[model samples]
Target: MPEHAEAGPSRTRPRAPRRKVYPTETFIDGRGDTLAIRTFAEEDTDLAGITRLCDEELSEPYNVYTFRYFLEDWPHLTFFVFPSADDPEPIATIICKLDMHRERTMRGYIGMLSVDKAWRRRSIARKLVELAMSRMELAGANEIVLETEFDNGPSLALYEAMGFVREKRVHRFYSNGKDAFRLIRPLAQHPLLSMAALRERQDAEQRSMAKEGGDNRSAVPPEIAVLLAGPLAPPTAAHADAMAELASLTIEPLPKPRPPPSYIM
Candidate 1:
């Protein structure tokens, strides 16, 4: 499913202000056209342009609510490319949001991306994505995720080139009954840190404790560890005998079957 939705109850604290001004960047494209990039501002009139770009290029039909969900909550996360410093109409735009996923980790979601056909092959999309990702990483996003049409080779290739991997395929995900591939890029987080050093330190501490006559029982029992290592193997002969003994002590054997009753004529 698309990441855009009603802000859930998991977000209880009030977020930062909605209309904070952000820095604007200017660059010259390959065609010698100067372009301006800036974060979406509440005062800007580029909403129509953004909607128009997506409506012109993408298949999904989005309403104003979808736009507001991403733009209003995370204005800084959305980037727009203008034709020049004075142009209010955006030629390209990318919308994104960051929120806690299942109350455990912060997840960043890219909801929409669109670029004008005239501006293709200029690497504008990549620049916008890189900007958004850097901001999200600074804001503590554990990972980023987005979905694109399964057959969109260009979209898939662009995302994969930026380190995203296909996580799964969702059937008939789009409004037009097109499949989508959910892609994910994991960022460096505490859970992914190497544990070898930690294990070695723990082993050394345990050895020191043993030398000092401290009781050092294994955290997990040997039998439980064996069971946890993998699927249980077939019961052994000794296990079968123990089970039989247990059954004999706890269960009563069935009585022999009695003959059927004769029916009276």
Candidate 2:
């Protein structure tokens, strides 16, 4: 493998086998239609539909090893969605895994999330992440993280809106030489949303309260105020948004100061 192509996690197989106890879940789409969300079963091994969705919606390629690595380690975290109970192919899918990331922190990583292009803008990806996060939190995750192509606006916006913060940029992170952003969010250790997000929410709520009636500002939650006071920037890694563009401006140096004119010739 090329340099950094096979990271520590990618080279090592998961310590345990994958397991799932959840049943098919009913999800409501933006169209007010019902959708089925379920885990990948052993017999449901045909992943062509999944690979197609990933290929169409994502910029990178996922081979059989990548798919098996995630599914075999945490089948419950691998989810596929159908338009309905009888739908033949999955319209969306998400793969997730849990592990001790540094310092013994139980971290939950969202490996992949893809939604059919036809199903774009329906908040399907957001719903898929929510489902996975809920399970991860229940499983005792201290934090959650994922990476997205630097230019993937929709994906970045979705994760950021859900309280994930851009930690840093991985240069040449993609096979095509494009960069990527590693986004993260704290789970059990802190609130689900970022402090900035909570502050925004509080501001909105305060405005609404004022609009309804004045003098109830005390209704604001205390923890929210504390979080609002915290540093505005989400710490850990540089924000993903910062990597959107590189500083390309070229500044020319000013001319060197001329010494007192020594008698012009």
Candidate 3:
């Protein structure tokens, strides 16, 4: 009765849930305690804590390969925070990536961010995100994007407060079949300039082609003026006949090739 299912046989048992990462220290929000944020390093290849944190915080589980795909290429984008020098694991962690987008603009992506449950509401997550964003901005990212559960009010509010806008809704995005909302934060890109502002500028530049009433179609862009030239696209007589002949044809089966004689015999 499920709408969608995998092709292979279902497993008899569920996977062992990843280990939970607990904070070793409390992040003093406004108290200004000594914060211990550290970037990821090659020596810290054992990513058990980060994997566990993402599995629990997100709707999906990230295996070792998935973690490596991002971490290996952009280790600087991954960060952690410890409460004290003796803390073994991070109380907070954020992972991100940066690259050029198809639109020829630099883009940054926040893949995962996790903060220990005990350290919630203490500004730990905010600090981690800001740190990552700042680094990515400095690294030439023009915009950033991320996805979160649509119902996660705290996450939505937190990111929105940090200037991320809800861009679109993804239908059934998670493995557990939950919908997600994709958020985007433009670092220095002026979206208004591309949208309404661009439109206004273009409108202001619009000129009458017939102002002097002499062969005037040069006022608009070449493509627009071409479109205004009207619908005179017609096939030649021979081409039209060929097309009609092709359309009247029916599908025919091709003979299957015979196999060569067996060498084993």
Candidate 4:
């Protein structure tokens, strides 16, 4: 997601016209499961859930938040929540802020990305980041930047895999003196980033069709064409079956060489 620079204690500037925002909603997963992704509206219930998730799963000491902080500032920030399919409660959250310092450059600041302990490694965080990037792009952001603890290997790797690069490292950047690394990526630099995003959505749709035990390759949406052109891991049973059906439709396939590894981040 985009990163926002820390605003100084200067006089408040005039606010820009607010864009039309839709209601928070869920995205259907590969198993016909619903994953809620919504804007942060200051409400008691949403605040409570966000607080619990951050306290429990994102216990980093450098974190900052307060009740008044949310009430007073959260409206200007972009927030999204991912609710668990089984429990019907929030499992993860991502916060983004728009940086107005640069023209036509929306700095995508990522803060408070946390997933429930029980929901780790299921691509929940990845999905959240993907959603954030999409939203930022839709908002006219040409690039995204974020910082993470230097020692956070999993996050570093995930961001790298998704096309971010280590732009700089600051010593003792956090209040507790932990070093931090700033990662940045241009949204248009890597074609694969968009492809991966499309694939994820396609995978979700394919899973929905498979749940009904019906073959529906014809239902493949045109918007998800990029995903159909590549191989994806954690494939649903229906995705595999659909691939098989597609394979039978073609003949005399040519041999191809393995592609090189990507090291964008």
Best by lDDT: 1
- lDDT per residue for candidate 4 within 9-85, as digits (tens), equals 87988899664344666676544667766666655546666777877875353223443333344343445546532
lDDT, model 3 = 0.69
Candidate 1: residue 4 Cα off by (Å): 68
Model 2 clashing residue pairs (backbone): 166-240, 167-237, 167-238
What are the Cα lDDT values of the candidates?
Answer: 0.74, 0.73, 0.69, 0.63
Score residue 256 of candidate 4 by CA lDDT: 31
Tens-digit lDDT track for model 1 on 1-265?
3588766576568887664334578987767777899988773465787789889978898877677766666787988998876666788999888876655557788888898998888888888888888899888777888899999999999999999999999888887999899998888752233234444555676687788888774344343333333346665554555557647765332232222112100
RMSD of 3: 19.5
| Candidate 2: C-alpha lDDT | 0.73
TM-score of each: 0.64, 0.62, 0.62, 0.53
List candidate 2 stretches off by more than 4 Å: 1-23, 43-46, 190-265
Candidate 4 — which pairs collide? Answer: 2-108, 2-109, 3-108, 3-109, 160-265
Candidate 2 structure quality by residue, lDDT tens digits, 144-220: 88888899887888899999999998888777889889998987454434555667777788788889887647355
Give the per-residue lDDT of model 3 (tens digit) for 161-222: 99999999988877678888999998765343344544454444554435545554354443
Question: Candidate 1 vs candidate 3: which has greater lDDT?
Answer: 1
- The order of the candidates by lDDT, greatest first, is 1, 2, 3, 4
Tell me each candidate's RMSD, in Å, in order: 21.3, 20.8, 19.5, 20.2
